[model samples]
Target: MEASELVQRFVSRMAEGQPIHTASRLLDELREDLIKIGRRSAFFESQGLPLQEAWVGIKFGEIMTFDTIYLAAKAQMGFDVVLLKDNVSVQFDITEATDRNVDRAEEYRSGPEMIVEDSGEIARQESLFEKNVGNRLKRKSSDNLIVYVNTGWLPEEKFIEDALIRWHLSFKKKFNSAYLLIRGSVVQLAPELQKFSNSRSRENGPKS
Candidate 1:
């Protein structure tokens, strides 16, 4: 609860005991998870498989947050948060899960932000969902996607699963998963998207 008491109470009042995660919190959680994932072998691994102790360590370098340099990053890494780590650095394209299928570009052109406004105007640009799904999911640097909805979203149920399926088939990319943070909830969206093999496309894929 590094955030002020008012922020905590504001979240609690909106979603009960469940705290709504902001962009800053989401970035921190991902950073911690990447480190802990390296230590999974210390406990349980995937099913019977365990992470090897020799391959357990992962070193992270300086982190690039989308706080002030988001516009600058658009020309380089192009992701909201660029986490530099050993081996290959991980890139994240963070966006606000707009209440509609279309993106509110004006509100979020500067990358994902702490938007206090409720859903209203939204226009389509190059939405993350459209860029990386179905046959288009095989790009080299699509980047891990994170979409979060603000606390102001009402229960209109705009971003439903069925619509995602249609959008999934139209696009093409090998993005494994898209993480969605709705108010105080977190969902791993589109894990069942078709396979993205090295050579062939749309064979079979699994969400982790």
Candidate 2:
């Protein structure tokens, strides 16, 4: 099925107040399948294949994350959604997943840095952030700058916190708009800085 059709069916079943137990299971299966299809389709399109070949190559697991988030937002809050490489931004409404939803908060927090580790991922995320921010300033940027950081793997909280404070102070001195959405423990931001700094140190090699 086409992505749109699949989304519609999923939403329709959901709106009917179907039992979460059964519906969620089905949704999970369908979402995984659809995303795999979508990813294959995207790959084929990139290869300049004909539309039919692209469609046939699509797998749902590849796009399941985007679709599930979109559907959740649509069903709960009626928000119009747009998908980017690392995050999904909602334009018309933001009620579905507020800052308080730990899951959404965690996603906004960690999703960006996860993208930053790889050059390709960084370029993709940067393009999307730029598109979302447009003419806006960076720090006062509000919800426009969410990224994932893989906080689960980092070290102690204090170490990360100190790093974030130092980074924030340095960045703020240069540009007040240097804010970022850090994921993982609330302390992951500092560790991310340390991670980057450590990587740079290794690249620069030993002091004289």
Candidate 3:
């Protein structure tokens, strides 16, 4: 199939159906893009998230359609995906905060030259979200921010909650809400931490 057809397939399946459970099918359809992924595939592989799954379009297909939260894909202007339910629609940006500072997902699709100053600095000077959030925050969180916090980038349970709490609190401008995806469990952390909000406060710092 042509490259354009692959994208069309992705749109047709994900725009109206349950793509949450259909990740593999989308991966297969879009697998050719893996060859395009090329050099950066190793970095993603080391992170334990294969190029097929980590690819931008494929990631959108997965974890997007499992619940009542309907995701209608949008253009670059705003709201990467819009939530539709009943008679209301909410804006959401499905973004990633990976271990590496670069937005490799966009690089893969747009074919830009990537720069890596120091691999040793990965997640050292700042948390995953902090490094990448600066650009995304230009909108200042008008749209709901749904982040895929790659495991290599962050940590488990409480540690992640703490990082998110610290990251969210540090910024005067913040997301309408922030949701973190770690190890298959989805945790909402901003505006509120669902269960942890009461225990957390701006003064609290994340564990190093």
Candidate 4:
């Protein structure tokens, strides 16, 4: 099928039903694009994430539909999918979502903690999130989004909640929003994260 037709199908399916579920399908459709960008086996290995498994790509379920839709559209349009194992962001030209000039997005996460308990893995991932925030923020995006994907073992709700709290506490002000892909589901970080960001700006008041 032509890329345009595929993009159209995506838009149609999305408009007809639950966006949360639609987003997962959209990601699946673009699986090839994900793998294409992830072809850099050497790069993933350099980062210490098992290159063999890295190309498997991330997954998302049905937590935050709108966020998923936004990401799905971008990914479908062909944003560069970089395997910055500890971080994921997207860079793209604002062009039509056709096959020819398409690309994907970037997602970040710490290398999986195979031996550690869930708490330890969560804490370690959180630390990686905190440690990488500054560097990820440095890459300016007109879209102003900070996106991350958790590659750890099955992420539970508690992990999501805790990680979001940390995100609000840490990088809330620097980016417009944070999107997380956990267990094959895409979700926006807490709304309060953005609210807190605005609050901080007000408290600090404009820098003179």
The candidate that wins on lDDT is: 3
User: Per-residue lDDT tens digits of candidate 2, residues 15-96?
Assistant: 3433324444554555465666663223212222122111111111122222322223334544322222244432321111
Query: Arrange candidates by TM-score, highest first: which order?
Result: 3, 4, 1, 2
lDDT of candidate 3 over 1-208, digit per residue (tens): 4444445555555555343345444544455454464432433232322222223323332333323233353443455554444545556666654444454443333211223235455334245445554344444455466665443422333434455576666442466676654433455656766532221111111111
lDDT of each: 0.31, 0.31, 0.43, 0.35
Top TM-score model? 3
Better of 3 and 4 by lDDT: 3
Supply candidate 3's per-residue lDDT for 92: 69
The C-alpha stretches of model 4 lying farther than 4 A from their native spots are 1-62, 67-126, 137-146, 154-163, 185-187, 190-208
Using lDDT, rank the candidates from best to worst: 3, 4, 1, 2
Q: List the candidates' TM-scores in order.
A: 0.31, 0.27, 0.51, 0.36
* RMSD (Cα, Å) of model 2: 15.1
Q: lDDT tens digits, residues 1-208, model 4?
A: 4443444554455433333344454535544433455433223223322211212121221222122222233435443222222133333212111111211222223224344457876687556544443244345353334243333333344544565576565444554544443333334543344211111111110011
Question: CA lDDT of 110 in candidate 3?
Answer: 21
Model 3 global lDDT (CA atoms, 0 to 1): 0.43
